[model samples]
Target chain A: MSSIHEITLMLNGDPVEAAVAAHTLLVDFLRDSHALRGVKRSCDMQVCGACTVLVDGRPVSSCTMLAVDADGASVVTIEGLGGPDGLDPVQEAFLEHGALQCGFCTPGFILATKALLATNPSPSREEIVHHLSGNICRCTGYQKIIEAVESLAR
Target chain B: MLPRPFTYHRPTSLDEAVTLMARHVDDVSPYAGGTELLLAMKMHFADYEHLVDLKRISELRAVKRNGGTLSIGALATHAAIAADAAIQGSLPALAGLCGSIANARVRAAGTIGGNLCFAEPRADPPVLLAALDAQLCLISARGERHVAASQFITGALETVRAPDEILLRIDIPLTARSTRYERVVHGHRTVAGAAAVIAQDAHAAPRVWLGCVATHPVALPNAEAHVAANPGVLDNALTQAIASDIARLDIADDEDASADYRRHLATTVAIRAITATVEQEERA
Candidate 1:
């Protein structure tokens, strides 16, 4: 019985393997081991959505979750979204709407919006607000972000 | 902040999880979702040398209805419970409440068992579960026993669950009762909350419970007695009954809300819950 757990999972689109300590957080593992700096770490508590990432297609606060928890799951971060040629549609929508200011909270907002749209292709304005309420954005005053996400709604 | 190093064990079965808990005693915690436990661990508020990961146990994730009971697996996440078809069809009020808890990320990762077991004073589920007369099933190396939801939480961040016990599931008996849960929330924390469960028959006893205003959820026996006697009446007498019951609760003034304000909100939410329950009954 060892505290060091060998975990293998799909990171973004690639299959990756790592032997992480039992106490290692998923956010630390993502940003430190894989260098996915896009996954911001503001407010280690789950209250702030800065550390949100998708595990098995559902958004979870990576900061509160253990790296080993993502072992058999497919995890998607902001770095996993766009293609080499162009940005993802969500990114394009955010860019078009000018949904960012300092852009520190942009990655988290974009990823949360992607998750929202993936499950519900057509979401009401209220639904979008309710879904993204966990992800805080102090820069854009949230109006532009809502409008940006609204533009992508079906 | 990082939690101290610990041994993580992912047990595939209930017996194995029980054995692990029994082996480690106070040094272990059954990790489910980890939305609350991990945060506490990182903050150095709690420490455990061993964590028995309960995610792999398939039996603990089942949400099903058998005969007259709705058995909700303890490990069922808030998001999963909100989206569960059976919950939506049978207990839509509970489903709606689950959807509104915390935010998208917390809902996705927070488990009902973890929420109830954590026994956070501001949590939402315990009140509703108690009002609905839910039975909590706990298993250990010794055997299985059921505790009424109302008696589960002893104090804030405390429960009667032993070190070797694991919460298996929540059993809610399906009855002809219309339930409504109402709350006032400041940010993610519930300020004051109430649950009203009114039976279809006017003669049957109605259940009302208030939470987030005290150390633990408590039954408003006086108010419930009034409701049970009057049946759908929300007059001055009912209001007085509610006020008397609220006066008995040991509420504290906190940064989230003042003691006076919480009492006001508690009374308001309780009236709203009962009114909504009555309205629901009328519609049905």
Candidate 2:
């Protein structure tokens, strides 16, 4: 007997309300219901950061988070990071660094990077490595990803 | 993989949370960040008929030091705990331990109470918290009681907390002369972890508590007595003896590593942690 919940959250700077199941995961809720596919569900488990999204400005694994838990919170997906002007600095950096090989893990890494930079604008290389350890990328060897963030730090 | 359907109840206060849990005692799980709970449910390792969401409870978001003890609210996220100035000032090792849990996303989502309640053998907080003589406040519709961190974790993935009870807060005495949590690695849950808290007084020898080398974190009365007896201890043999003694408990093995390897790693970590604080204690 699953129950439906009316969750009103600020999605990507806009107040979006939806009716979701009690067991609806945030990733699926965003992707399936809201048609926000930027949150890649690579690792359903929290270990892989493919489903990373900013909840209340803090990066949270949407796959592990319940949709109801995010009610009334502000959530930022990869799609939300983009402005009318152009790509976000993180996306541009990834593109400039050729950080993505398959691009599957790009959204997670980009979101994590965005959160990291927002909090610690001048994170050291060690800091960047330490903070982003949760997101796993299978391609590009992560050297370019680190460099991408490093470039932002500089 | 999405978890099986479970009714969700978001309670804004501790009383409401506990009562909701008590109403569905056998089937309700108090949800925090849902980092571990959802993962377990998705893996088909757990199923709950109801989940009492505790995240909205503001009382459980405390991270402060009051009356000589660092009182950490159960709902405080790992990232908050790690970044807390009070925790850093009093128990940097605990802060460091919290900071290194899983990853950035988990640190942002997971809470200290949830981590300790899970009681995974490969856990980090219990190891350090137990060593630091932390106390946990448990609340239920029945009543409330404080349990020592050392006694909270009875076994792997098992805790003394009743299904109807919710862990409200964690209180750790900020008393160690110098504390150090030495891990085998970072960016991963520790296969083996050693946390050492040293308190040296003119009235008595240094008191030491050891954790993560056994099924549960334990007081090294045997090893402490040995170290106290030999105040200027500089022998490798004694360290080996202490290590073996600490590893006397049953250390189980899973895919992470073999029992022997786990014990061996535990011994190494314990010895290193002990030696580190002991040296600091002696210097001070």
Query: How many residue pairs clash in all the candidates, one count each?
Result: 0, 0
DockQ of 2: 0.85
Residue B265, candidate 2: C-alpha displacement in angstroms: 0.9
The stretch of ten residues in a row with the least summed lDDT in candidate 2 chain B is B200-209
Candidate 2 lDDT, tens digit per residue, B145-241? 9999878988768899999989999998777787788877534657677776665453454445554545666666666666667654757765766
**Local distance difference test, per candidate?**
0.91, 0.82
**In model 2, which regions exceed 4 Å deviation?**
B200-215, B231-234
For candidate 2, give the lDDT of residue B180: 80
Please write out the lDDT profile of model 2 over residues A61-145, one tens digit for every residue: 9988888878889999998986999998889999999988988888899999988988899999999999988889877469999
Candidate 2 to truth, TM: 0.95
Model 1, runs deviating above 4 Å = none
| lDDT per residue (tens digit) for residues B201-241 in model 1 | 66778999999999999999888998888776889998899
Model 1, TM vs. native: 0.98
User: Cα deviation in Å at residue B268, candidate 1?
Assistant: 0.8
* Predicted model with the maximum TM-score: 1
